[model samples]
Target: MIAFLKGRLVEKTPTDIIIECNGVGYQVHISLHSYSLIKDSESILVYTYLQIKEDAHTLYGFVEKLERELFKLLISVSGIGGNTARNMLSYVTPKDLMQAIASNDIKTIQSIKGIGLKTAQRVVIDLQEKVQKMYGLEDLSTSVYNTNAEEALSALEVLGFVRKATEKVVKKIVDQQPDATVEQIIKLALKSL
Candidate 1:
């Protein structure tokens, strides 16, 4: 349960990095995306997940919580090992992965080196609702829509509608109109609520 390592990076590679925290060097496995982001920095705070097995203990690190969350979700799917999950994170961005799973684009997920057709399909089926719940995605095409949608959701929550139900309605409205303003979204959400 090593939540994170915040220290100087002593060694780095595409696959892993050694971070020195409080005079101790800890080797942590990482995805390519994390490597690229931390390669140029002197110090880093790597979010970590420690996996314990009968034979060995391993630590996987990510530069962002989004990446780490995706890693955990990927590993939770049937037939996806830690290595396979890491490989998937290395091969695809978290945003793209969520989009692919939500849109049921099995081909995009299967494009990863080790992910096969069945695993990809299973990932979509198992994670699609989880992803949607975690992200409350409507139209991921722009950050603006997401922000407005979230603001409207908060407003709806303040208005006493259950957060989950309001989120569902607001996300549906957002999906139908990506350019909806916060007020417009709240108004439309009120009607739906």
Candidate 2:
């Protein structure tokens, strides 16, 4: 039941961060969204969920309580696991996910590279009510779309979108179209890849 951690960040990468608290180092997996907000010499805090299995005791951290809650909700879905839960957070924020769920916007949810229509629908059906209660179903789409381009590019790499593939796609698309949306960038990226 580790609710949160406050510490000096000692290391940072796209997938994980190491925080040194009271002379102890805690390695925690993170989403790129959280990684962007973390910087050098700054104290940071993250809500955490610990999963203990026979072979592993893994700690997953989130920059926001909503993200942590969503992570819990994601993993609770049948056939979804921690990696997929984290992946969902990588591309979608708490607000956006909720809005999509509330509105039954399966297309938006399915647009993420790895998710399918059925999975998207299932996720929305399962979580819409809970999210509406929690956040009032505010419009999270624009914010999610804006922050997600950069974050999703990083996450794309994690999901096996090759670096060369991403670089070629993002650079060309962003260069030609400064105001391109995440979906547009991804579409162009598919062509590039």
lDDT of 1 by residue, 1-193 (tens): 9999999988899999999999999999999888888855778899999999999999999999999998899899988888999999889988889988876778889999988899999999899888877887543434766699889988888878899788768767876898999999999988877
The alpha-carbon lDDT assigned to residue 64 of candidate 1 equals: 95
- Identify the runs in model 2 with alpha carbons over 4 angstroms from their true place: 138-193
Candidate 2 structure quality by residue, lDDT tens digits, 57-113: 889998888788888988878767887878777887766766677766788789876
Backbone clash total, candidate 1:
0
Alpha-carbon deviation at 57 in model 2, angstroms: 1.1
Q: Which structure among the candidates has the greatest lDDT?
A: 1
Error of 2 at 36 (Å): 1.5
- Each candidate's number of clashing pairs is 0, 0
Clashes of 2: 0
TM-score of structure candidate 1: 0.72
